[model samples]
Target: MSMGKKILIIGPSWVGDMVMAQSLFILLKQQDPDNQIDVLAPAWSRPLLARMPQVRQAVDMPVGHGSLMWSARRQIGRALKAEGYDQAILLPNSFKSALIPLFAGIPVRTGWKGEFRYGLVNDIRLLDEARYPLMVQRFDALAYPAGAPLPEKLPVPDLHAEAARVPQLRAQFGLDGTQKILALCPGAEFGPAKRWPERHYAAVAAHKLAQGWQVWLLGSEKDRAVAENIIAALPQAQRQRCHNLAGVTKLEDAIDLLSVCDAVVSNDSGLMHISAALNRPLVVVYGSTSPGFTPPLNEQVAILSIPVDCGPCFQRECPLGHMKCLNDLLPEQVISALEKLVPGHEQAVL
Candidate 1:
């Protein structure tokens, strides 16, 4: 038996991208069972990497996103020289993302040609978006030779949750995990354009609560207000069953807790990807963005979007005053999608 190749991957900064990167890791491991994979990512992604079984270890990228701290990157890169990584795969297209591996003197650095990353990455492949339509496809392609045919059955990211901590997390959050859980992720880090209306979320929550299910609102502190608004929209009795855990739980806690959800209704956000990776029955709503590019990788997912003329603009906020793309997308549509993904739920309230 021979020790396989050791690879260092410069991971993406966003949570969703990091989740998708697991596909590439799975592909590498599938190709070579002995392959050792280490991820270089932001500190926030450490918990995410921990959930990925393919990752041997996660090295935190000292430099923040968009920061070109040459000396800092050099220091970190030089420090990793002792690891003797056989190959470095850069997931981000930024020129800065390629610098560390180059500085570390890692042989066979691989990535797409972006931002004039000519000499920085020796094994650069010009990306053909038409050929590789999905982001996961592009990432998985790097695991093989340039222009090589990707596996017909690409592995979807399946994140492992710390089930032992489920009890502790439930106790900490005053949740018993006795009732059916329906998680609603209404916040989009991308911006307001991607967020489904709060009232719409409330409608879903109200319906689930009527069916004797608990609603868990998930997001960062930035989404606390939105979560609160959703709860406020619910009737007083329904609000009692709703948990506003948006700002309350850490990323890891959210991951473990989300594993127990019977179903999830979310915007096209990081948590949406997380829920899908957990293999939860997911209903994802898209507004400013379209599913053509980064649809949920899970099989049990329903993506809902209303097409408008001004649409899929991929903007932070709607350019026109009316956000008909999202506002026009009724809660009933999402509830219908959810019922399709997870049957036996009560009919939605119009």
Candidate 2:
């Protein structure tokens, strides 16, 4: 087996997808301890790649999100070609996403077959969605030989930022040192389709606080109002233990705070993936999206999704004008998941 091979991976634009792909990085590292894995991704994903030690370098694909993808691909391909990558794996399923490596003239271009980039990609593997139902399974297929055994189900990548960075951030945020941290991520990028009811989140947060857990709500500014609503529902005494960290921490800081949490309760969002990557015990709520496609990778993680007849639609918005999947999830169900994660919290065993 050759060592020091340069592999350039075209990463997924979404944060959660990136987290799911981390297992591929782990496999590549295991094959050759000295392997050089570089990533070409959108500017926002750079912070995430920074935390992964397997990546030798991350080249930002300098382009806006909308159309105009070709122009950006050419630019990224030119930059990657200069670095002399031996092989390239395209993670995102778009013809435009493969353009960079084609233009760069990388020797082996590998990816799934959906993109119809015949000339651009050399080693296109035919993907049978039925055989490989999960997103991680599809991602792993890209790296292996035609029918090689899948890499041992490795734990999701656990890459921490500098040790000093997390502590400084904890102090900056005024997080309680003595209390067990319970990270709450109440927002979903897939609109309101996958979001659990705010009242259930509040109830669960209040319940955890009564047991001496500190609730740190996590989300972007778009989620601040929802976080605020949950905070308001908590009792005044328990509310003091609930710190709204929304709109404050950057993506990197969010990872740091998540690292410290004893467990995280989150909607099916990028934050949930991040917590799973950190190996933190996670309770993920599901609604519109099916766990079959994008479940958390850790065995320690618990996923709760009410299987409604209209579910697995994968729609951004509820199509039936009702979101019963999330609205109907009880606070007690969430509390039960958390109790199993929390040490010394005894509950009736199933």
Candidate 3:
């Protein structure tokens, strides 16, 4: 095992991508328990990184996505020079993502061949599409020598949630401990193409509510309206039982609260990956995107997707205007998956 190495991991921009990156982190840790791994990502990701025990520190990426702030990259990169990172692994294949490590003058910089980044990344890899089908597979493969066979089972992301924070968050959100919690992550930051119909989520919420469960909607502030709509669709009695925690809880708060959920039903979004990492009983509804690439890394998940000729187009919004893939999928399918998964999880409820 490579011992006492210091590494810098340039994390991905999206939450799901970042979560999936944990597999590589776990792999690196397994290689050398004493290795110190630090992540460079957006400031918002600090909370998420804190839950990852494998990460030693979270360095906030000052620049936003899309725009390449060379000065900003140079500043952060030069600052990291003193840390003396032995190896810098760039997760995102973008040309800009390679700058910081290069500016830092790290000796061993590695990443997939992207945007013809030659000198920016020294140990560049040539990706054989068939060999590394999943994004997680691609990420984990970087931890080994060029032609090394990956382990039979790559480590899955298991986040560490503070046990004591669960109750406080429950109380903060007015969550009833008596009822089984069903968390609905109805928003997909990628776009509407990946989101399951909000009405469909409401249907699952209603069903679980009928079974004496308290439904909680979780997502960013952008998802507030959808959460409210889901609640509005519920009957008056059930509406009172459901809570729209979306737009209210901070990312860390969401992490702690989600850890205690009896079941989670989410779109193919970051929360889906987070739920899987938390090892929650999850039923993820897929639309434009298929699980073939970035499926939730958990055995406790039930992935629901319907194949349509037009999709998985992987577009931000559907070009055909008809969301038959997700529309046809229906809530009954997700609820049924939940019914099966929840009972098994308790043995370890929806």
Candidate 4:
């Protein structure tokens, strides 16, 4: 643990996966404070990676999204060779994900066996899913030496990256600095299957605005239409106070803004993870995905999921046609959940 090892990490391509991967980065720092950790990741995740302080640099893999093989492994191998990395941690399960380090001849490469990559991965570990209490715990175990016990759980993510533009963003957006701000991330990257009803979010925002808090809509370009729908549902007075930041600002800008919020309401998405990482008070709505595996870890966070027969369908879209799991969750219920954190937060303004 004391050795200053040069470690190269092949990062997860998805934003949420990238954020979740921060725990591993944090553990590496805790285990070896001086180790130089660099990440080989897809370009899209670069925005989020910039915020993590643990990573020295995020090497972009110039390849398409699908099962892209040639560029990723080749680029990563050349980079690892040039950087003289001694070990690598592959976060993704694909054989292509492991190809880089193995090709680079890094002495130790670790990952779960997938795509029959036995020889490609030297230190492959069997993920006894039952042994670890949580998904994060299971992922964290991969970073430790073989047979090492799980350490006491910690909440903070290792991404030492910061939101450099938050302060300016606050001024530009005309956000009331002193008043409590509530971030509403209504869209889920996974798909409509995981997203709570738009009405539910609108109601939550309306409830908070009535309580004297300012509502800030958070999401990407794809989520802007949803944000607008929610904004449109609010009363003119409430709408005036609500800000639609979707697609306007960068990813770090949203995180910086999220860090400043008194609380956040989101679906099971990357922003939820960011809110948890920042230790912001949060109410995360879960639908197709169960919270049992990767629920919010921060003390200030809470999960709002209604269990149903088709609870963990785990599909991109609802197979049953009736998205009862999400639609059935009333706005009042989410408002009630938020009220606990921001007291009188619902009744104050109205």
Model 1 CA deviation exceeding 4 Å by range: 345-350
Query: Which candidate order results from sorting by lDDT in descending order?
Result: 1, 3, 2, 4
Task: Give the worst 10-residue stretch by lDDT in candidate 4.
Answer: 154-163
Best by TM-score: 1
Predictions in order: lDDT:
0.93, 0.84, 0.91, 0.81
Residue 306 of candidate 1: its Cα lDDT?
Answer: 82
| Model 3 whole-model lDDT (C-alpha atoms) | 0.91
| Prediction 4 TM-score vs. true | 0.93
Compose the digit string of candidate 3's lDDT tens values, residues 129-244: 89999999999999988878999999999989887998888888888998888999999999999888878989998888887888889999999999999999988877888999
Query: 161 in model 4: Cα distance from truth in Å?
Result: 6.6
lDDT of 4 by residue, 40-139 (tens): 8878777787778888898887764466577655765876687888888887788788788877889999988767889888999877778875667766
* Candidate 1 worst ten-residue window by lDDT: 341-350
Clashes of each: 0, 0, 2, 8
TM-score of 2: 0.94
How does residue 26 of candidate 4 score in lDDT?
83
lDDT of 3 at 250: 95
- The superposed Cα distance between candidate 4 and the true structure at residue 113, in angstroms, equals 1.0
Question: Higher-TM-score candidate among 1 and 4?
Answer: 1
Give me the displacement of residue 235 in model 3, in angstroms: 0.5
